[model samples]
Target: MANNQGRSVRQPTLLEVIIVLGLFLAIAFSFVSVVDLPIQLALFIALFLIVILGIRLGYTYNDLQEAIKSGISNGLEAVLILVAVGALIGSWIAGGIVPTIISFGLEIIHPSIFLLATLIICSLTSLATGTSWGTAGTAGIAMVAIGEGLGIPLPMVVGAVMSGAYFGDKLSPLSDSTVLTASMAKVNIIDHIKSMLYVSVPAFLISGAAFTIVGFTATGHVDMAGVESTINSLNSTFNIGWIMLIPAVVVIVLLAMRKPPVPTIAFGALLGVVWAGLFQGMDWIAALNTTYDGFVIETGEAFMDELLNQGGITSMLGSIVVILLGLGFGGLLNHIGALQVIVDSFKRFITNTGRLSISTVATGIMANIFGCAMYVSLILTPKIMEKNYDEMKVDRRVLSRNTEVGGTLTSGMVPWSDNGIFMVALFGVPTLQYLPYMWLSFAAIILVIIYGYTNKFIWYVDDEEEGQGHELDIASDQKA
Candidate 1:
């Protein structure tokens, strides 16, 4: 599909794009299921297909290489953040912060309302931290531990944890996706936030309701025997005191104060080291080593060992690699114009506000699938649909809102995606198992469609007004 200029590419037909994508997905699924290899291997397989497509399209290997580099570069900061969070978790656990939270958590947080409470707690934490990963790795883990102790299904607990985490990630001004959506759609950040509440609030309320109903109906009684054993194990393994919580509290407070994630999390990790050495009677070298190797407890109790034996930079390496691979794959697709081809193929049908909004949702989900992360979806969907919104006299904020619904909200649903891989690795819950439980994720999509079709909260430009644009005129105008 190249004309000249060493790969002036022609747009791919919809069928051509779908065939390649379908083949890539089949390879990925086969690798993950039948082969049972690491997910990164699946990404590599998909990347290879993309590379082949680029070459066939007359793109040079160097061009494809550059694209891959661009993709990996986009996620470098997140990779570092993942490593730092890993260190933070390792230190937090070794220093007794997580154990302390669980101990105190088990006492007051009744098993009956734990899921409801989890949704609220995680939302607040992620909103403050502006990171679902950090929230999931930290407070989310604590909630999972608490849920396990209460005998709740891990999927239900992880579902609640993720639903809240995404709630914050979508609405929190601190979130990159929120900021990116605002910038991309040319909407005021505050306006974007306010408008998003129209969608997010309803989704959150529904999700919260679902969690509450599940919580009250479930037979998730506190396992008094397991709880006592866990408490004893925590008390024996680490100093059980309120002082251990200072590190976690400091991290959350610093994040809430708008400190950069890298430095804030780095400080949090260091505080864990100091706290562990000073309070837990660990040698300085041993405490520092935990940052690399993570917290490891050889408690005689298998359950305690399983619960406590996680965290550290080493533990996050797999996730980091997966992210890089996904980014590289996405980058290549972008460089080869594969994503644009797909979007262009789909964009033509978006003739009105409702169709545009719904199509944007579909684009967001598709971009995440093909582009491999929320970042790409956030970038690609708006780039493709911005004109359609303007043509429909729709405010860009609605575009931004729908983008968040499709992109950030669905991040954890894709198995190899940034949020998905990290959550799976951290919680050991497979993506599909928890996907159904992310009620807000799907709710956001449904809500967007409802809002779109109903024309509620969607602002349209009026032509008869002084803005020099008529509604019917704008809607009727077609691109040459």
Candidate 2:
């Protein structure tokens, strides 16, 4: 009921303010570095108060309550996905599957062909493991050592390595970013995956071609001997075989069967434990410890030592912390209406459905950069997307999948971003070196445009089924 003042009677209350602000601050403060903790925390806390003050001053109690609910409600499922992603990381590492992948990776690809191979290899491993960081930090490191020892230009190699890692990260259905993107957009993850190929495949193909051309033409020197030794060392350390492909295959089949991700990865992880103990001679007790704690090994070869060693749930802690900080900041921006204001500003430009699709892709790209994390990008995406969808009467999954296609996949090129950091560290190459290899991300962006404006693979809905995401709707989206 409207009050005498003509405002909605269900005004947002003050208590909701306390819950949101407290949650945001708690998450932000938990991740602040020890050295900068005091300053960052104080600023974050002050910002929270400022938001509440701004709302109380400008909005009705109802508006405030709704806005708070709008922001928090949007992210409710995201929190669960984040924790599941954490567990997935731990289980993958514990299973010895990650180490096994790295071992095989070093054996198959050559240092001369390394740049192109790095992109392909990392892409596959990240695809298999559904983890860009794990692929980058492990196989990526080995590639970097091979690059450094070979005298390949650091930036070129780093750029290529990062590009490959993130491509895998973006495309892998097992990835947290992929899963969360689907959830937030309210599309089935399979639909999200299918939609992603609209951009991702072309981008990866072009990137591979570019890197291959560069590899053939480059004058860079590399320590082939050191690379060989490292590869040999890794081969001896783990049971590297086609048999290791089982965990990855299981994930693919389960996802294809329309199973949820948490169980799929959990099952994949269990497969890993069995294989590690059975084939690699890794004791069951040690394998379990590695899953819960962390895992690393020594080969005694100078460069081959840390190069071939790493994984565990512990490896993802740093990434998780970084992710939380970005999410907390984004949540505050959303709470204060900055996010909505930004989204509204886009509406002024969209005169038609075609234009809105173009704009949606642009917004997705920008969100990935500004938010600096997939969780934030996914959360912030629908702020503008829903308005456009409602205005144009396009399917919500169209906007949702486009956001995933554009934002989550393109994070590889941002030099200061998490994917970039992992790639740089992994290859021991600076980001600038392999920028040419990053053409895959660019290609993906272009593909999103084609999908949207061209309506080529764009999924639409029947009048009755619109907005309510169902399995049939998802199947139709893909089929359509």
Local error of candidate 2 at residue 184 (angstroms): 8.0
lDDT of 2 by residue, 1-480 (tens): 453346534323345435554564454445333344532344345445545654544545455445544544444443333334344444444454555555555566555576788787678767777766555544565465556545567666666766777777766777777787777666677776766666677778888888888776673455556556655665667666777667766765665455665565556556666776787787888766655454556657665555434445555445444444444444445545444555566677887656777777677665654444455666677666866675566666677666765666555544333444334333434444555556766676677676556766555555455433322364543443
Candidate 1 stretches greater than 4 Å from native: 1-8, 463-480
How far does residue 227 in candidate 2 sit from its true spot (Å)?
2.1
lDDT (0 to 1) per candidate: 0.83, 0.58
* Model 2: residues with Cα > 4 Å off, grouped in runs: 1-100, 112-201, 217-220, 235-259, 263-286, 350-358, 369-402, 411-437, 446-480
lDDT of 1 by residue, 252-274 (tens): 88887878788888898999899
Q: Which ten residues in a row have the lowest lDDT in candidate 2?
A: 31-40
TM-scores, one per candidate: 0.93, 0.62
Query: How many clashes (backbone N, Cα, C below 3 Å) per candidate?
Result: 2, 13
